[model samples]
Target chain A: MVEVEMNGTTPSVRDELITEIELSFGLLHKAAANFDNRYISRVFRDLGPLRRKLAKNGDALATVIDRLYPHNSASRAYLLEVTGKTDESMDEETKSAVKPEVDLYIHLLVQVYLLDNNRLEELNKFNDKVIYLLGSYNRRSLDFIQAKIWFYISRTKELIDDLHSIRPALLSALRSATLRHDTETAASTITLLLRNYLLCHEVNQAMNLVEKTEFPENAGSSLVARYYYYLARINAIQLDYSSANEYVIAATRKAPQTQLAVGFLQAATKLSIIIELLMGDIPELQLFRKQSDSLEPYFMLTKAVRLGDLKLFEEVLKKYEQAFKKDDNFTLVSRLRQNVIKTGIRIISLSYSKISLKDICIKLLLDSEELAEYIVAKAIRDGVIEASINHEHGYMKSKELLDVYSTKLPQDDFDQRIKFCLSLHNDSVKSMRYPSADNRSDINKHNLAAKEDEMDLLKAIEEGDLDDFMD
Target chain B: MSLQKLTAELYQLYDQEEYEKCQKILTPIKLELIKHNLLLPTVANSDSKDKINDLKIAERILEIGALSSLLSNNYRGFENYVAQLRPFYSNKQIHAKPEKNTDQTKIISLYLLYLLSQGLVSKFHVELELIYNSKQYNVEQDQYLLFPVNLEKHLMEGNYIKIWKVLKNDTNLPCKEYGHFLDTLVNALRFEIAKSLEQTYETIPISNCKGLLYFPQEQSDATFESIIKDDLKMTGWTFKDGSITFKNDDDSHKGNVNPNSINLISNVLSYAERIESIV
Candidate 1:
């Protein structure tokens, strides 16, 4: 293959080039089959030069090669495919066994080009072609391809801020992946769908999907991490900070160390810190040093939250404003200022249990004592501090700290964990599907055992009543 | 359709402000170029002499696409086209004549303005740095590009009056698209002024505000008042005795706080205690 002459002086060289192109096409097909993005991109990159070399030869055999590869043809149909204007006539198959594979490769190439050029119209055309092709074939067998196409479609729509319009395609992708039992695609499609819902602020819909969708048990770690990350975001939005923190922690732990997964981990860590701070607990000191250096801003942000330094927090926000915005964490970061102030007041309450309102105003850098009074009253009401404000004397009085052993808080925490476990079990049961007939018998057996147990309890109760009358 | 005819139709639609129609016409032409292997050249492999004309045509199409996207306020689209044009422009192969490069400057200016209007200060600086670092971008030869650069500097220094003066005195704003972005920039400036006033002053004469904001002489007081009262949501201004007294109200305080900052601390605390007690 490497011996092919670039000048294409002879027939043998041309044949060699054609064979090489065919081999690359075969590799591309395998890559696509395995959903290997890196391998697919590499094959496409390698084919570009070979196709150009064949085009330059300008021989009868070159024309044959062109017919197969079609490097550059002015035909409208060819143009449509290359520019991602899909749904054009697919009548010109090159009588090759790998025709469909070639078609898929060409469509993907054009889609990437159009996407790079921000050509939304052409991208939409490509999406239409994918949808049309899926409908024309056995969709269950084409689940991988369908999932890949939907991923690109959803991504393009998201780039153009048309995420709201991607519901139908995403739903179909999810359904196909689920039906085919393709765990990776199902996990990915679910994540994409959940993200769209979160972006649109449809928290209820996102939660309902989380409850209903049965993620395959063999999902990849990264996909599972994404699931937890999105669940964390949803819970955070719904003000369930404890559950949100748990999910974020799970996500950060399970997230792989790939470049993309690192970003997810960073985001999860950021949210986890915010949630922990909001819960009046400081994130562990080691968390800041554990991640890569790119997460340094988050570490500084954590410090600002811990120290209750409003000025430093604002500075950090302004310095990394673009980064935060890119991560979609700007709103969350902006909301941390209130937490900073609260934390400042908490520190002040601990230091000076009977601080005057004027002193509190100075300590928190509040503009007026009235604002300080309002804040202190709010803190007391919210239970951030075990203290009461004396409106007449303009001072806050802190109560004595209770012993940890005397508190029922630990018992309540156990109950809450149990409740969460029960809910998880119920959700799993609801989402479980008996796709094959063999699984139905297992469910029936379980149902029968439950019924027998209920009958036994009833008989015991009836016998106890008769025994009581005899006595 | 012939590429020439399609290109002509695209310019016509663009001139008439029919951007969507222009895009529709350009798509097929772009596809044709791609099919003919002329849209982008592998410069390392291809001899420049053999494909100069094709490269020129490709460059022209990218320029038109960039302009159309700018006019339509599609920054991402504009960036895509500009990325395609960068190698050509940076190589000094296209637009060899400085005098004939006004369109390039206009596009660059519009891009700068776009960054400024979006409040992307870091990105704006990055773009300007790229231009300064490039060998082809001579400040003296490309003076037309200085408008956005100067405006950005004034914006950074909080010199709104200087920005107003630059916009008012400069007659050479590159193109009509500059006007649209300038309007957005002026709105951002007005917001800054409103915020500063809310922080510093209790009231100012409406006449002084007109001067401070550099409202055009032709614009009526009623227009300015509506912008202030309706668009700015500043109410309870006493427009009497040849002056307007801005009332100190919660609305003014609302301006003092960053409106985007959500109050999650209280909500979090409410749940935090319950969870803590249970834990």
Candidate 2:
């Protein structure tokens, strides 16, 4: 290490340099406190002094801090300070002067935090600095470095109520760190934030951010897929299916390459189609189904549960069982199979009006209470089961059949097809004009009522069930 | 030697009705404005046309090699100065007028007039200058509140006498049907302004070619007259005599140019004379 000499013509020069260094550090601190209004701070402090000193002496302040403070808290803080994470200081000249030292400090702090997983308090203490560095750093390589730290700090195992505090700080961290010019950095930051926003159920905020974001045109298929996924899911929740398909198709354009990515994209694409069906945009259902069928059985199984599609729920479960049987290792596949079976049971419970919880439990071979209640709760929360009755029992009364979700038809070209389907079912009653049966045929007499119920459900599925609900 | 001498020379040229000469003498001084990126072309439709004619006069002056006599600075030197000022010009930005109309429209109109005079002034200061980069400022900030009669509030006025005088006494359409024509004009102007501002990102032309308005493909004299009957109040006189006159509130003022003022008419006339001499 090169030793910095203190006796350069004694106290006068040292004192002036020290005063300048102290002033520069003070400005940096003030900037961190009010980074949003950086322009005002620069005007107040007059960035000329720091910039001139930085030009005159390269990292002389860091050297002085080392000579004076050594390895104390103030020294570590000074080291962290050396990183110059926040570039909100008014002088662009000063920023360019001390950028290397700041970059080194940032990389060092990030490495230290990542290595020592026990540094929770240390990470929390310098959380703003980490965010500042992340935002200020120009390198695209640092994307995951900052994100991993954030993910570790915030997503420690499961979410807690206090986790909400980290969310805004994390958002600010990205805001301050991400530059408008760097496409890769901007796209990654947007994707991470969008995922967090979707998980946090702040759909409106996520959508707003996505709308404002300018992503790279040449970003990998995965990024585009995620972009559409976030949009479709939000619009799915908002019940705006036509708008959702616009994004889903955008996602599909980036598909057909990565099967791993296509799994999620296919699921979202199918979900968008189902949403369109629910919103009464039934024409695109065939196209969506073709995409969903190409995905693996397990992928389709989860979607069926989320969509509450009874027919898809059954078909995918059947496919899952066949795949499981062929493997012959029932022990390994048993848990996966059980999850699919639960999803199927939930779908039936959600799709039909008359289907009881008892029937669902028996069909799934699940205990009447725990597994059945879990399915019902998940269905209700996902909006598969709309709350219907005002019964004293909250959960039971809240449950709704799939028919309850058929909202007012879209007033567009899509509405014409829906009208046609409705007409095919309701407008003209089929009449078989024949001589009165001499002794009413036993087949018709035995149970036309049972046949009608089956026929009605089948017809409903054929008319609107064209949705790619499984995936 | 003194700022007053320069103003007097300009005044003399204006008084002689030598407007082109006045404009030429003002050209070197206008370089100061262009140096500060402040020589905005006149925004009035009529004045922009006048600018083209003035430019032709400048070209003719150059061909005669009289420009050097008129301008203290050489043409190459002025060009160099303009080049040096380009970066500063590009960096300049002005704020959007706030949606909330806290600014007084009369004050804004006066400010606009002051800006025009500053552009015309021989010696202008950069620090004191307030630039208007937006075209919408004239319509939204000036026309609504500063104009003698606002279209929106015309019908709602409690001063029935003033309203009736503006209508029946005015030499436009009959005052009874004033509402129909004026309302249409007000709505059309509002939409045109809003549309222009919404469309353009750069400094918008506040006024387009006057020819677009005055000389249409088809002759519609009645339509044109009805549209600007109020504005014509300031510029014209009895149509039969073809004499230019202005409405004077008091008998104290004698002429359209205010002859009683110490230097007002002389100053205007000198500027006019200088402009004519340049041509």
lDDT of 2 by residue, A29-82 (tens): 433453322222232233334434433333344444443332422234535353
The positional error of residue B116 in candidate 2, measured at the CA in angstroms, is 58
TM-score for all predictions? 0.44, 0.26
Query: Alpha-carbon error at A164 in model 2, in Å?
Result: 2.1
Q: Give me candidate 1's TM-score against the actual structure.
A: 0.44
Off by over 4 Å in 1: A1-124, A139-141, A175-186, A197-218, A290-293, A315-320, A367-371, A390-394, A406-471, B1-279
Q: Estimate, for each residue in B85-179, the C-alpha lDDT of model 1 and write its tens digit.
A: 76666544544555334677767767777878888764564455446544456644565677777776545334465667556654656556677
Interface RMSD per candidate (angstroms): 17.4, 34.8
Candidate 1 falls in which docking quality class? incorrect
TM-score of 2: 0.26
Q: What is the TM-score of chain B in candidate 1?
A: 0.72
Off by over 4 Å in 2: A1-128, A132-163, A170-180, A211-222, A252-471, B1-279
